[model samples]
Structure formats: structure tokens, C-alpha cells
Target: MPSRARLKPRKMPTQQRSKATVEAILAAAAQVFRRHGYAATTTDRIAQRAGVSVGSLYQYFPNKDAILVTLAERHIDAGFALVRLLLREALAETPPLAAMLRRFVLAMIVLHEHEPELHRVLFEEAPLPSHVRRRLRERENELASEVSRLLEAHPEACVRSPDVTAYVIVHTVDSLVHSFVLHPPKDIDADMMTNEAVRMLLRHLTAEGS
Candidate 1:
């Protein structure tokens, strides 16, 4: 039962060299965590993998948990950045609900594809810290808020509750895309899966009278 404070970095890197060292540590951490998983990963192994002294690793991170938390934060930040980009694109065109959903679904699929194993290690398999989990939830809520606005602007999306529908939309797309792309269940075609997801969403959004 470690405190959140124990997970916080001892000091932020200010100099360029120190910054590079931090980046190396993070890159090495990704490999080490993916290779060893969370529970078994140690600061000594991460430092060795990074080609840095263990004392140097401790200069930035207090413990192995700090490194993992930092890595998870970076991952979540990237996901939210993708959401922000799509939010803007969706707003500019205000395409049909299905069209917008398709774009989002595909973009998310690509994001996951780029680093599925690392994502699996950080998000799917590991036991995340409470603060890290809270950060992930906040980013998710931010994406949900964007979806709510997108639905509000979409000419065809007529759900009674935009907020709740937005929650359903985000979770449904995220969970379905992650599960399907990362671990397809026997003979799932990507195009067919995308089409059906779009169809299901369009139905939920435009269905009249509950």
C-alpha cells in the first residue's frame, strides 16, 4: 500500500541532457514493462535497460511505480490528443452520425495498432495506480464531453439524452474497437466490424421514442 506521494518523481528534469535521460528511461521502461509486466518489473531492471545508473533513475522517479505511472500518463495523453483532433474534424464537417463514428472508430483502431502490446501492458493487464486510473477516467470524460457536443451538432443524431448517449458512444466505441482489434474473435473482418459498429450507433442515436 504505497502512498501517491511515494509514486511522484523526486525531481523534474530541467536541463536538455536530463530531459534526454528521462526520455531514455521512459523508452526503456516501456520495453521492460512490456517484457516483464508490472508486478515483476523493478527499478534496477529499468535502469539497466535504459543504460543508466540506478541512482540516475531514482533522480527522476521515486520508484518503479513512478515510471509506470508516468508511462501510463503519456499513453493517456496521446489517446486524448487523438480525441481532440477527431473532435475538431467532426465539428468542421458535421458529417452524418455514422460517417463521424466511422472516422473515430478507424482513427482509434490505428492508434491501438501502433502500440497494441504496450497498450495492453499499461492499460489491459497491469494494476494501475488510483491516481493514474483517475487521470484516465478524466480524459475519457473529456472525450465523452466532445462526443456530446458532436451529437448536439449532428443533424441526424436525435437521442433524448445527449450526455448519457455520449458516454455510451465513447465506451462502446473504445471497448469494442480495443477488443476487436487487439483480440479478434474468430474470423472477424475489420470492414464488416466497422460497418456494424457504425450501424449500431446510428440506430441508437436516431431511434425514435426510446
Candidate 2:
């Protein structure tokens, strides 16, 4: 991982044109990273892909690592947005635990399935900055806290420690969903994966003497 200073973008876009340029760079960087793993991607390649000059690219991002950091930040933000939307819907409906867990699991699968290659590069291949990793951990903790609240409210939940259970649930769903979508087995598919994950979670949360 690079130092925070090294991963920082050179400048922030303020004007409409500058913002568009920044967006173009990020989009191009994502494509480049997807096509060629992070190790092979370069600032010049991203500049060419964005149809911008190297000088212009430098004006916004100091280096490819900076661009990667921005991409990672955007990816994290989009993921959180999706999770929050599902959480809001779950809260509104107050569905059965099975249904809720299924929804969460399916949503995660779908999110990863959208661009599995890009996700793999961002999360698995790229060297994420320390701050970005910290942010991810913080977001996961926040999500776990929300899940804990939901578990506490549910009548069927029999877990002794909602906090611990919620943390486990969040990490389990995230890990399994990512693995199933990004590196699926030859025999198992998304539907099967979701069903098994939900079943396991339901049993753990609601089983007798849990």
C-alpha cells in the first residue's frame, strides 16, 4: 500500500468541464484496470483511454495509484448506496428473517456479478491504500450495527449476542457472495449459493439454544 499522500489525487475538480474530465479519467481507469490487472495498468494507458493528454491527466491525478484510489472510493460508495437501499426496504417491510437474508444475499451477488472482473481488480488485485481499507472496515462496522438493531427487533431471533451475530452475518454474506460471484464453483450457481447462505444464517440465528 502506498502512503496516503502518494494515493491522493493532485487536484479536485470544481468546474463542470473539470468534473467531466475527472469522470472520464476514472471511467477509463476502470476499464483499463478491468482489461489489464492493476499491475499492468499505467497512467499513460488511462490517459489514452480517456482521450485526454498525459498533462491533463496529471493535472487531476498525480499517478495511476491516485486514480486507483479514486476508483476504489467510488466503488465503495456505490456499494454502500445499494446496501443502504436494501436495508431501508427491509426495515419498511419487516419481512421474515429468511426473506430478508435472501434479499441481502441476492443483492450482494447481483452487485458483484455486474462487473466481476473490475471488482476483483479493485478488491483482490489492486493495492488499496490504508485509508481506503480503513473506510471499508468502518463501513462494515456500521452495517453490522444496523444488522444488530434489526436482529434485536425481530421476534424469531434467538441469538445471545446480536452484535456478535450481526458481525458474523455481515462478514459471512459479504465473503460468500463475493466468492460465489467472482470465483464460482463449477457445479454451484447463484441461486443455490443464495439459498444455502440464507439457510445457514437462519439456522444460526433462530435455532433452539442458539
Candidate 3:
């Protein structure tokens, strides 16, 4: 594993060209990682795939680990963005709990399904930098906090401890959705998985005498 300093990007891309170059490199890295897996991937392959020279690649990222960290950061940011978007839409319409959960579950399944192979390499094969792991935990907690507030505001959510219940729901949905998408069973499709997850959550959250 690389040291924290070694995992940091050497420089930030400020100029338009540099920013594009960085984006290309990151995009290429994602493809290379997906095709080659983390252990087999090399910086040379990423650079070639990006159509950038090794020196140019090194200018923005110190090494492959740095690029991986950036990719992980982008993925985390995107996931949170989607979650927030769904939450906002739900709040605006104040939809039924089942409808809201379905939206969230289906969105997550679709997001993971977009690039399951890439995600497998990023999350399972590669070693995340310490900072990236820390950021993930922080983001999960932040998301849980947001969900707790939402549950508190909702009239039907009769959970005794909204905070703890929100945390459980968030993590449960995340873990189950990720597993269902990435390692789906032969018999279960997206619709079935989504319906089952929503049903289970609704039962727990809106259970009789809860």
C-alpha cells in the first residue's frame, strides 16, 4: 500500500486543457482498472488509454494510487449527489413512503448496474487510501444524519429512535442494493429486488405496534 502522501495528487488541474487531461486520465483509468483488475493494471496502460504521455499523467497524479483515490472520490461524490437529488424530489412531492423507498432503491441499483465491473475493482480489488476510507465513513454519517431529519419530519415514520433507525436504513439499503446489483442472484432481477427491499423496509419502519 502507498503512503498517504504518495496517494495524493501532485497538482490540481486549473486550466481548461489540464482539467480535460485530468478527466481523460481518470476516465481511462476507470476503464483500465475494469478490464485489467487492480493488480494487473499499470500506469503505462492508463496513460496510453488516455492518449496522454507518462509525464503528462504524472503532472496531475503522483502515481496509480493517486488516480485510484481520485476515481474513488468521484464515485463517492456522485453517489451522494444522486442520493441528495432523490431526497429533494421526495421531499418536494412528499410521496408515500413506499414510493420514496422504491425511487431510492431503484436509483441505487441502476447506478451500480451502470458499471459493476469497474465498481468491483475500485471497491473490492484495490486498496483504498486511508483518507478515502475516512471520507466514505464521514459521508455515510452525513447521509444518515440527513435521513434522520427526514424521518423525524415524516408523520408515518413511528420508529422510536429516528437517528438510529435512519442510520440502519441508510446502511441497510446501501449494502443490500450494492450486493444485489454487483452479485445478483440468477433468479432475482432488478424489479424483484427493488420490490422486496422496499417491502422489507416499509414493514420494518411502518410495522404495526412499532
Top candidate, metric TM-score: 2
**Lowest summed lDDT window (length 10), candidate 2:** 106-115
Residue 53 of model 1: what lDDT? 100
Candidate ranking under TM-score, highest first, comes to: 2, 3, 1
Better of 1 and 2 by TM-score: 2
- TM-score, predicted candidate 3 vs. hidden true structure: 0.93
Q: Between candidates 2 and 3, which one is better according to TM-score?
A: 2
Error of 3 at 206 (Å): 1.8
Reference-based TM-score, model 2: 0.95
Model 1: per-residue Cα lDDT over 64-174, one tens digit each? 888888888989889788867877788799887778888877877876775677788887777788889899889889888988888888767778888898888888888
CA lDDT of 119 in candidate 1? 86
Model 1's lDDT to the true fold?
0.84
Q: List ranges where model 2 is wrong by over 4 Å.
A: 208-210
lDDT of 2 at 166: 86
TM-score of each: 0.93, 0.95, 0.93
lDDT of 3 by residue, 99-163 (tens): 87787677667657767888888778899877888888887887777677777667787788888
Query: Cα deviation of 199 in candidate 2 (Å)?
Result: 1.0
- Model 1 TM-score is 0.93
- Tell me, by lDDT, which candidate is best: 2
Q: List the residue pairs that clash in candidate 1.
A: none
